[model samples]
Target chain A: MTIKTSNAGVTVIKKLFSRHETFVFLAIVIFGLIITVVNPDFLTLENVFDLLKSYALMGTFAVGMLFVLISGGIDISFTAIATITGYVIAVLLLQNGEQLNIVSVFAIAGGVGVLLGIINALIIYYFNIPSIITTIATLNIYYGLLTVISKGKWLYGFPAWFGQYTQMYVFKFTAANGTSYGLSVITAFWFVLMLIAWFVLRYTVLGRSIYAMGGNSASAKRAGFNLLRLNLFVYGFMGLMAGFGSVIQALLVQTVAPNSLVGKELDVVAAVVLGGASLTGGTGSVLGTFLGVVLIAIMGNGLTLMRVPAFWYKVVIGTVILISVGASAYRRKVSARRRTIIEVE
Target chain B: MERKYSEFLVLFFILLGVIGLMWLLNGSTFMSLNNFRSMAFQLPELGILSMAMMIAMLTSGINLSIIATANLAGIIMALILTQTIPPEATGPGGIGLVILAILAGLLVAAAIGLLNGFLIAHLEISPILATLGTMILVSGLALAITKGYVVSGFPPAMRAIGNSTILGLPVPILIFAAGAVILSVILQRTSLGARIYMLGSNPLACFYSGVNNPRVLMSTYLISGLYSGVAAIVMISRFNSAKADYGESYLLLTVLVSVLGGVSAAGGFGRVSGLILGLIILQIISNGLNLMGVNTFLTVALWGMVLIAVMVLQFLLNRYKEKRRSI
Candidate 1:
């Protein structure tokens, strides 16, 4: 009986390891291990925790991007959305000082994001304009507006309480090498958001419909799905995330450059794509996105450790995008061809 | 056919509107000879870039790498010119080398275009993701080339194209006019242009019709590359320098200009004339705002607002038309 149970356990392990998320998780582990081997300081508790902490806001963006991608569209404008909403919050925080309630900032940022997201949804759904194209235009508009209102000004030296709130670390430790480490409120927020995204995508009717829309829109329509309403919710939710992402980014960085997040749409979108989210949409996961965010943060941290020039990072990102996207596409083609061959046989 | 006429009429009125607004805001100063010359100079580089964007968008594709490609091509040409021309060589020999550099830059740019075409048309990747990758890669390569430094000092002859005026017209504007004419002919008269439109409209149908779709797509981007090569020359001349990041801001602006010109983002439709009008309106708005002491960043926002407004209006019009047809 013991031998039979062990055999069943091995099969269960094999089944679990075959998932895309499993590979991504392993890749993160392998990456960590490899970096730790090369520069042993990399495995230090402080450094590892710091690496995870860095991706807190980006993880937020990826979660949002994953939703948009799963619905068979792209949203490059989210970066712009994040910038504009964050700028509003920052300006309010600076001007209002003692009188401004923190809750109001969150509400305003979220409200602005919802408004912008609805605008995106309305234009995209009403006209069926390509999401990327529409977002491209909106990205410019939003960033342009931010720069105008901010007048190229950067907000710095946030109220210490604001920063300390998110910066509050839940875990703390010190190593023999005298390095200190802790998981912060921001990191907790990232995980909680990821968990919520996973739950929404997994357990909700809206989440499954997002997948159905992406998998096959025409069939989804035939099955009585409302693409327009779904788009509004999906893009609006993305905008809300952007608003939250902005708050997280602003609080963490404590200096809001109106144009800081302008070009980061590519980075956010790339992470989602790297997580196995299809550009063609209808497929992705919350866990996969979290892993993707981790992979990027780790890679960037590792590269910095290796002393690679920061400028070459785009090359690395570009190559990864091409290879990952091409490989997935090629796999799909091969599988389809194989299925056709089987049918003929 | 009526749509074409309506677009032209709308462009004419918008042009008039900008002129009227400029006149009202800045009065006679906006119409000064110097203002016209500066505006003319500013117009060509963007105008040419918009034309380049138009061709790509004609196929419902976006080449986010135009500024990068232009900068790289200009850098290479600058390198060649700087290498071949001795500081003392101010004669016809310097002129000859400049021409050679232009040809080389155009050649390299065309090759880049073909690579973009192959990635999109043959590889079957979404245009956005494919071009996004190439944009980053190519720009990285450009950055690696100069280690992020500017290259400058072209021969007098090369600079003349931008700085000199011919027949009371800026040379850049003349070149732009010539380019516009040539492109209009190529797109309207040539078999290649027709095939591109057909392919853009429906690739599967084109395949059924044996239209050599990939080759058409290749040539489409190749021409866009060649146009970028031309725009690079004008830009380098205007600035008297070339750098990896020059014109970096124009990437999104070109899209704005293209779509605002009524180029269907869905592919299979766009016009050079309409684009020219759109670009002119943007130039006027920019120059006019500069004169009025409005923040330059606000202009960027204005462009965005204009684009969004235009997109929304287009949607409304399409809806109205659909509704009418259903009746």
Candidate 2:
């Protein structure tokens, strides 16, 4: 009985190894381990919290981007939208001073995001322009508007409470060595948001609709799914996430620069793809995206800890994206070949 | 007669619209010879990039690496003109340097384009994803070679080629006009052009008809790369400086010109004439924005709005055509 169970466990391990997500999962674990080896401080509880805080906004952007990618589209304009929204929020708070409440600011940011996403959807769905092109154009438009409005100035000097609130510890634990470790409020917020995202993606009709649209738009249309409405919702949701990310970023950094998020869309897309999402649309999971984000964040952190040149980080990222997409293509080809063989037999 | 008149009328109206907008915004300053000269100088490099983009779109592929190719060529040009050949060289040596730089640029770009074509056409990788990889790779190389620094100090003749005008017209504009004419002939009057369109429209049908679809795709990218070399020379000459980051801004602009000019992103449908018109319209909008002192942020938003509008208009037109066919 013990020998049989061990054999069964071996089979399960093999199956996991064969799965696509396993590769990304393993990469994340390995990256984390390497970082710990390079700098023992990297594995410390305080550093972990710092890493989480830094990546919270990036994670938020990835969550929305995952939805868009799953819905068979791309949104390069998200970073631009985030940047402009950050600028607008900064301007409003600076001008209004005592009158602006934190909750109201969040609400306004969400509204701005929905509007931007709606615009993207309208162009893509109504006109049938490729999402990449539409988003690229809008990226320029949004950034241009931000530059004009802000007059290229960096906005700073937020209320002291804003920074404190983002950084405040919500919980603490003592290690066996009598070292105390704490989780910041921002990290707690990120965890809660990600948990909710994971649940919605796994169990909701809208979430499944996103996958359906991406997998095959015509089939989805035949099945009575409203492609236009879904596209709008997906892009709008992406925009809202961008806005939320901006708020988090502003709170964390305590200032907003007009050019703060330039070229960030690439990083977000890379994370989503690395998480096991395909550019061809469909076949991605929020869980995969979460793991992908963790992998990328750890890779960056690990390399920095190892004192690797900054250029190698970009090279590694570019190479990984290339190789992953190549591997996915190869797997599809092999599967197709197998099917052909079975048909012949 | 009516169709001919309509075509002429459309062209006339477009020209008038451009002139009227410029006149309204900057008054006589917009029509000034100096402004015209500057505009003329600007058009060639972008024009070449636009043509490259159009050809790629025709093949149902995209060449995101075009700007990278141009930047690479621009770096080579700077190095050759500034450091390699002496300022006093004449005749064969001077010509040799120009030829060598141009050839190196074209060759490097073509090799990259070929890699993209093979991956996309043969391996079945998505064009966007494949080109994106090359884009990153090439840009990284460009940065590594130049180390984010500018290279300048070209010989007098090279500078003249870039900066000089002929008969009250800039030389770059003249180069653009010449390129447009050649491209028109090749696209409109040649069998190769027909094969390209057929392949783009329906690859399976073309393959059944004994056309080598892959070859058509490969050649299109090669031409795009060659054009990138030409555009790079023009750009380096005009700016009087070559840097790794020079053509980063051109990526979106190139796509915008292709789409707005009536080249269907779906492939197999487009005209050189329409692309030329598209280029003019885009440049005018850009020039107008600059002249009017529009806020930079608002300018981008406005451009985005325009792109969205153009795309919607194209979609409506396509739908209308389909409806007519069904009827």
Candidate 3:
């Protein structure tokens, strides 16, 4: 009876491991173990919290990208959107001397995001331009306009509440070494954003429509899904996330530098694409994206802990993207071949 | 043919409009010989890169790795120049070394292109994803090798390709014109070029029609890479140095130029002449902006605006033509 139960447990484990997210989780564990072995400090709560704090901004962006990729599109403009919106808000706050609360800040940012996202949707839908091309053009336009207007200036000296908000820890404890550490409030934002994304993608009809459009747009249209509405919602959601992410970034860095955010789109793209999100759309999950983010954060942290040169991090990330993307693409080809009808009577 | 010429005419008018605006803004300064000379000197590296991007986009694909490829190729050439050819050398041997270094750089680019092709064609990876992957990997390799430093100090003769004038025209411009001619020939005259357009319009149909689709793709990327190599030589020579991050902003400008030149983002339509006109229009805008002492960032914004404007205009024009045909 014990053997039978053990066999059943083994089967369950195997089934879980077959999932993409679980595989990524396993990779994280094994990689973390290796890093911990190399540096005893790697496993400590202090370091883990540090990693999370650093990646929260990227995590928010990844969730937005996850939506875009799932809808069979790509939006490289998010970084530019985030930067411009954050910079505008910062400049305004600096000029007006108003101590706006965090909620107000987010609302303003998100409002701006929706407006820009609608523009993206309209151009892409009405002009029949590819999402990537449209975003690339918009990215240039938004970033250029921001930089031109701002003269590439950096803004700081936020309202008094900014510090208080960012400084608030979710939980705190002192280490044996007399150093205190806790996850930052910003990480909470990331987590909440992730949960929202997961709920929307997993259970909502809108999410289902997005997936359908991604899987086969023609069929989705035929099935009565409103393509324009879907495009607007998906891209608007992306922009909204970018707005939130921009604020989180500003809070973390304590300044708004217009040029800082535009070039970092690749990191978000890599993280989402690594998580088994098909660029052609119709497949991806928040859980997988979470793992993907964790995996990348770990790799970066582990490499640093191992005393590897920072350049290798990019090499590793690049190789990981290629391998994961290549493996899935190869699998698709095999499945497609298998689906071909054969006459063997 | 009439449709093609009509597109060119639209671009020509836009060019004239920009030139007129710049002339009004800066008066004689914009029309000065020095400005024209500087623009001529400045345009080729970007133009070459744009052409490289154009070839890829012609197949409804993109090589996000074009800038990365140029950097890597330039870095390789820089390494060769710094390592083998001493900075002070001036002789046939030095020239030979320069040639050799250029060859090595081009070879590296070709290899990267082949890798991209293999991944895209045989492995069935999407062009964007595959090229993006290569872009990262190659950039990482470059950063690893250079440790984020610039490679400089080439022999004087090597810099001539960038800075020198040949029979009253800048060498870089000459090279660009020559390249444009060659590319035009290839696109207009070669069977490979015909296959590229066909494949771009519809890949499955091309495949079913007995065309070697993969071979066409491989050749396309190979030519694109070679163009990037040429651009690299010009770039490193012009700057008298090479860095992994050089021309980082050129990637978008190349795309902007391609689109402005009438290259369809969806693929299968573009021409060398149209591309030249696009290049000229952008150069004029940039030069004009500089002459007016306007912020450089605004130029970037204008490029984006121009791209969108052109796209929308084309869309409207196509719709109008359809309506006219129905009538």
Candidate 3 residues B47-162, lDDT tens each? 99999999999999999999999999999999999887464564653687788899999999999999888888887887888898889988988898899999998887788888
> What local lDDT score does residue A316 receive in model 1, on the 0 to 100 scale?
71
> What does fnat come to for each candidate?
0.57, 0.54, 0.67
The per-model DockQ list reads 0.52, 0.50, 0.69
Q: Residue-wise lDDT of candidate 1 within A223-299, one digit each (tens)?
A: 99999989998899889989988988887788888767877788888788778788664778887788788777887
Candidate of highest DockQ: 3
Where does candidate 1 clash, by residue pair?
A: A214-A282
lDDT of 2 by residue, B1-327 (tens): 553344445645776798788889888878888777788888788989998888988877778789988887778777877777664665543665666666776677778778777767666667777777667767767776777789987666667668987997788888878878877787779887888888789889999999987787777777877778778878887888889888677888787788777777878877777777778877877887889897756766776777777777778867887999899
lDDT of 3 at A179: 86
How many clashes (backbone atoms < 3 Å, residues ≥3 apart in a chain or on different chains) does model 3 have? 0
Which is superior by DockQ, 2 or 3? 3
Rank by DockQ, highest first: 3, 1, 2
- lDDT by residue (A193-279, candidate 3, tens digit) is 999889988899998999999998899999999999999998998899899988988888889998788888988888888888887
Off by over 4 Å in 2: A1-14, A29-45, A95-104, A173-182, B1-12, B80-95, B165-169, B189-192, B204-212
Q: Model 1: DockQ against the native?
A: 0.52
Highest lDDT scorer: 3
Docking class of 2: medium
Judging by TM-score, tell me the better candidate of 1 and 3.
Answer: 3
The stretch of ten residues in a row with the least summed lDDT in candidate 3 chain B is B85-94
The window of 10 residues in a row where model 2 chain A has the poorest summed lDDT is A159-168
